[model samples]
Target chain A: LAKTTQPISMDSYEGQEVNITCSHNNIATNDYITWYQQFPSQGPRFIIQGYKTKVTNEVASLFIPADRKSSTLSLPRVSLSDTAVYYCLVAKGSNYQLIWGAGTKLIIKP
Target chain B: SQTIHQWPATLVQPVGSPLSLECTVEGTSNPNLYWYRQAAGRGLQLLFYSVGIGQISSEVPQNLSASRPQDRQFILSSKKLLLSDSGFYLCAWSSRTEGPYNEQFFGPGTRLTVL
Candidate 1:
């Protein structure tokens, strides 16, 4: 598992987009970047994943630079319920363990 | 569709007491199961993982142990509970296919409080 770094916290307004960036300078070729969203008293939920370039889902978009040293998770039109901790991870294989960072707590205010 | 289920939404145990938490996956076979603990204000710590029935791997050396008696069934147990063992426990599983890169699906976590 490759180590990842992310902001500790962020704030956003309702109906606004929130972008959380993560840095994994030592990421490996086989490693893929993945993100999870966790709310208080609940399990972490899968957000998006990408190896390179970009990946998008109904909920969020993941953008990876050509260098692949960093990535960003973009959440569109965040609502109050979007307030949660976001985790960034890098894995090489199925058995590849996940190393979680402190996570970025996004508080969506009205 | 596959779903993971965990028991005892919350537990409060006394020091020196034994502990056991169970997790089972439905609608899936030969899946990889994992146990993770999340402490307040911190990231989740991987406790154990199982690849097959009766196969278990411990990421952190501690009093807690994990077992897989059957496919899709994973258990976390401790002979003597420690205060530090208190935290949010999460169960997750991923398909064995896709060669280890499959995204993991998590179950609602169990909150443990040790007295």
Candidate 2:
């Protein structure tokens, strides 16, 4: 089974750039790296996704290296509202493809 | 314009009670459905998924079972609730059009508290 590893928790001040890295060495070939964010009492929300190189959207940026062993989610100038748990997700099979990271609980202080 | 809905935003039940949670999707056809559980301060745990009606695939072995009576409806049930069953339940769906590795969209989630 594929697995993803990420920092358990992180702390950052308001208006600071935050970068969360995820390690998924067993990720399937051609599988896209996905990120999700969840606030308390809510379900996970899709943040960004990428295959390789770099992809940027209004919410966040995803950077995947050549080997695809890992990926990073870069949030620009985060604020207090950005405090949430971020997860890294990937898949291998059609039936059993729910592999995901443990999540990083980001705390942004104002 | 696709959306997924899960009923009973919050529930509190005693142990040994029967349990049922409903999930439905709209604006999509023949999509993949998934049920997940998340304990406090933990990651999401995949409980069940269905590719179509009556094609449920369970990921973890527990006192829970799932059924897909309709293409867009999924249900999670338990004969007797366990104290350990208390957690936040989430329902999600993905389209095959996104390929074999589709990104899932999650519902608002239901919080269950079994005492």
Candidate 3:
């Protein structure tokens, strides 16, 4: 499993966009970058996933650089309800194997 | 549409007592099941995974054991609980698909407190 590095915490205000970046320098060719959002006392939910370039979903967007060593999750117009921990995960295929990082605590202030 | 179910939502057990947590998947068949534990203020730790019935792979060496008795049913058990075992347990399932399109869906989670 590849290790991921992310900021321990971040602060943002409502209606502002938040972008959290993760670095996986040793990412393998088969590895895919995935992001998950976890609220207090709730299980992490899948936000977005990407292998290269950019991928957009109803909730967020994922941007992967050409090197595939790093990726960013962009949340548009974040709200107070978005205050939660965001985890960056790396995995391969349909296997149940996943490596989870400490996650970036995003505090969406009013 | 797929849904994962786990119970009991919260458990408070005494140390040295036996523990059993169950997880089941619905609307999907032959799904790959996983057991993960999230310590307070920490990240998730992969405990065990199963690809099929009677096949389990453990990622970490611990007192807990996992079993898959049916296609969509998985269980995490311990003969005797420990204080270190107290945490939030989550069960997840993913379809057997090729490539990197497989995204796991998680259950509500079970909070176990060992006293």
Candidate 4:
């Protein structure tokens, strides 16, 4: 199984860009990095997904280095509503199950 | 478009009581189903997943078990609830055919409170 590690929490100001990075040292060749955002008492919402390089969606962007050992989720001009627990995850192997980390609790301040 | 549904939005149960949580996906067939739990201020913990009907995989050993009686429905049940079982329960579905990424769609979630 591919385990991910991320910071427990972070703080950012409104209208500022935020980058939360995750480390998956033992990630397999087929593993894909993904991110999700969760608000209080709700299921996580998909933020972005990527295998290598970068993947950008309307909500956020995912940047993966060439080695694929780590990935960063970048939020541009974040707002207060973007404050949530952001999870970094990877698929294990042969289409492995999504393994989640402790997540980065992003706090967007005014 | 595809959507997933989980019932009884919120539930409260006493310790040692039986528990059942239902999740259904609409407008899709033969999806990869998953059951996840999140404690307060914590990340998601994958409990169970199903690739096909009657095929369930347990991730973490616990009092809870999962069943897939139909292609698009999954059930998470516990013969006897434990206080440790209390948390936010989420049901998700992904498409293997979509791609290698396997992006998942989640339901609204059920808040389980065991007293």
iRMS per model, in Å, is 1.6, 1.8, 2.4, 2.0
- lDDT per residue as tens, model 3, B1-115: 7889999999999999999999999999888888999989988898998888999999999999999999999999999999999999999988866533467789999999999
Q: Give residue A11's error in model 3 in angstroms.
A: 0.5
Clashing pairs in 2: none
What is every candidate's C-alpha DockQ against the true complex, given to 2 decimals? 0.70, 0.63, 0.62, 0.66
Q: Which 10-residue span in candidate 2 chain B carries the lowest summed lDDT?
A: B96-105
Which residue pairs show collisions in model 3? none
At residue A50, what lDDT does model 1 achieve? 96
TM-score of 2: 0.96
- Per-residue lDDT of model 2, residues A83-106, tens digit only: 999999887654456678999999
Per-residue lDDT of candidate 1, residues B1-115 (tens digit): 8889999999999999999999999999999999999987788888998889998889899999999999999999999999999999999998887644668889898999999
User: Residue A2 of candidate 1: its Cα lDDT?
Assistant: 63
Candidate 4 DockQ category?
Answer: medium
The true-versus-predicted C-alpha distance at residue A25 of model 3, in Å, is: 1.2
Q: lDDT, candidate 1, residue A22?
A: 95
Show model 1 residue runs off by greater than 4 Å: none
Tens-digit per-residue lDDT, A2-101, candidate 3: 6889999999999999999999887877788899989988888888888899999899999999999899999999999999999999885445346677
